[model samples]
Target: MKKRLRDLGEDALIARLLRGFPGGENLRVGPGDDCAVVDPGRGLLRLLKTDAIVEGVHFLPDTPAAKVGWKAVARVLSDFAAMGGVPEHLLVTVAVDPAKPVAWMDGLYRGIRKCLATHGGVLAGGETSRLPSGAMISVAGEGRVERKHLILRSGGKPGDLVVVTGRLGGSIRGKHLTFTPRLNEAAWLVRNLRPSAMMDLSDGLAKDLPRLAEASGCGFEFGEVPATRGCTRAQALGDGEDYELLFTVSPRRWIAAAGQWPKDFPQLSIIGRLCPPGQGASLAGGWDHFSP
Candidate 1:
């Protein structure tokens, strides 16, 4: 008998199924990074990202269709933000129930267009299809980054200060559907400081922090977590979809950036330090798709 998807789990499934996908010569970074990075033959690099949002799995059927559209594209844009890039073009695939109202689909695309426009991205066209059960969205986007500003998840070193932009947790209350991608803030970070490593917090800090540590072959020590109001510490750590930037920087850079950090930007918190391999690092809480 075939093994169930849950038996494989999200991480295992991604590793097993996508481990061998062929990457072209221009591909600088492939699977495992927030976005695939490619050298476009210029001083600038192109970042490619694809993400899916499923009905019921990611949102309620009753959720506003406009919000649904906003989330579908924003998810991928956040990946660009994680790498300190700016979104330039987008392609969306919408799979919708046949019985859904035409107005609903219109609102969805309208919201998508509005968001792409706000973020200086173009709706470069897409495909649509009918699904038997519920609506699903697939977004494939491209962004550009200056070579000097490009940040990756594997650049972390021991002694780097771990930091997070904005608050975390409680996304299920409604933030997930409408949060803005941290494009400006991430760009600012790269322009001023060389982040040792960076990633977006989609899978919660508990799950994502471990990923950073493992990728960099290191561990970390936790400090005060900047949890969203009304959220318990555990909820802050485990509840996924915060859409914030979690990054590492050298202590010297932190002191310099801290002094000149934009007061108008979202709050920044120094949450910990990366440790050398073999040291204990907290991996206490996070979401697992296969888990109940």
Candidate 2:
């Protein structure tokens, strides 16, 4: 029997498909991290990211098309935030049934424009396609960050204290559609804390934390994860689409960093530590694209 994607899971499938792709001298980072980093010369590093939202997978049939559009754009922006980059331009591709209302498309674009205006980006262009069933929106964008500010998932070190911005869980209770991307919080961290490593939490802490640790070639030891007001610790760890920032700092630096955290932003919580691979306990289960 042929090997199935469900068996391999999303991460392993991605690794398998991207294996042996040639890297150019200008490709600073590729594939595995939140955004692909390119050295565009000068002092700037170009960030490239693309994200998609499907009607059934991301939003319900009655969910506002505008919110869906906002999510599509915001998701990419979150990735840019993870890389400490500022979005400059975007290209949006929309796939929907031809029978869908024109008003829906209008609402979607309105949300897209609003998101770009709020977060800083231009809707350069995009494509439209006919889908047999539900709607899908995909946004691809480019951003820029200075070399000094660039953060990658692989930069973490053992003994680094793991921190997360904002509360987690309860996304299904409407936060998923409305939560703000952590652009400002990330900017603050880059300027003030300079986390040893960072990434946005889209796939739940249980899933994404391991990815970050694996990328950094370390293992993680976690204690408390802050849950949303009506959520439990398990939900906080397993509920995907939190859209908060997950980052690491040196244990010695965490005290000062925590003390300097801005009052305007959402709360930051100390959830864990990154330890040498063999010494840390393992976590199991979260959101997986092909897993049942």
Candidate 3:
């Protein structure tokens, strides 16, 4: 019989599953990373990403309709932020059970509208379908970055400084519900310093950083990670949903911008450096879809 994930727990299960997967040419980073990376070409790249949130899988049945809607949009926006791209438009598709009330659907749309307005994202177009199961929300976002300025997981070189835009862990408290998108910061980074490599912390850095290293053909060494208030070291390393930017820069540029970066935003920090790839990406913690 196939073993259930809960039998092995989150970390062991992910290790086993990822062990069998192979990397692809277009994929600078694959399933084990913060986010998957694909190279579209050299100049003026388009970033297209989509995420789905299901009623029971992603959120509770009683989750506020508006919050659910916001999350759907925010999740895609977060991916754009990771790439340091400017979000221009989005297409949202929703599926709801026939029994769900019309007002609930209205509330969901209202939440989506609020997020779009906040992020300066234009609602392009999408479709709706009836679901026999429960509600499902999927959002596709379109963003653009100058060819030279686009950041990828493969850009980090050995000895480059690792930096993060915000604190980590315990997002379940309330931060996950109302976290900001980091749109402005991404723009600033792309325009000004231009990180060597960049991605957002959707999955824990322990899992994601290794992916970045693999893409860049390097490894990493962490000195200290900036922890969120009330977060443990393990939590800081493994907890997901921080939605903060993780990037790399030249050591010299990081020193020059260190003073200036804080003036504009309060959450930035340098966490580690890149090294040559050795063993596969090693994380202190891991997440698994099938594991508990």
Best by TM-score: 2
**In model 1, which regions exceed 4 Å deviation?**
none
TM-score per prediction, in order, is 0.96, 0.98, 0.84
- Name the candidate, 2 or 3, with the larger lDDT value: 2
What's the lDDT of the predicted structure labeled candidate 1? 0.90
lDDT of 3 by residue, 1-292 (tens): 8976667865456677788677776554455433344566555566667788888876777878888888888888888877777777789899989899888888888888998888878999998999987899988877776666667777888889889988888887766766787878988887777899888877678777877777789888887788888899888888877888889899888777766753668477888888777833356564545554
Lowest summed lDDT window (length 10), candidate 2? 252-261
lDDT of 2 by residue, 188-268 (tens): 889989999999999999999999999999999999889999899889999989999999999777777667777798988
Q: Comparing candidate 1 with candidate 2, which one achieves the higher TM-score?
A: 2
Query: Which regions of candidate 3 are displaced past 4 Å?
Result: 1-43, 262-264, 279-281
Q: Go through the candidates in order and give the C-alpha RMSD of each one to the true structure.
A: 1.3, 1.0, 4.0
Q: Pull out the clashing pairs in model 2.
A: none
What lDDT does each candidate get?
Answer: 0.90, 0.91, 0.77
* CA error at residue 225 for candidate 3, angstroms: 2.0
* Number of backbone collisions per candidate: 0, 0, 2
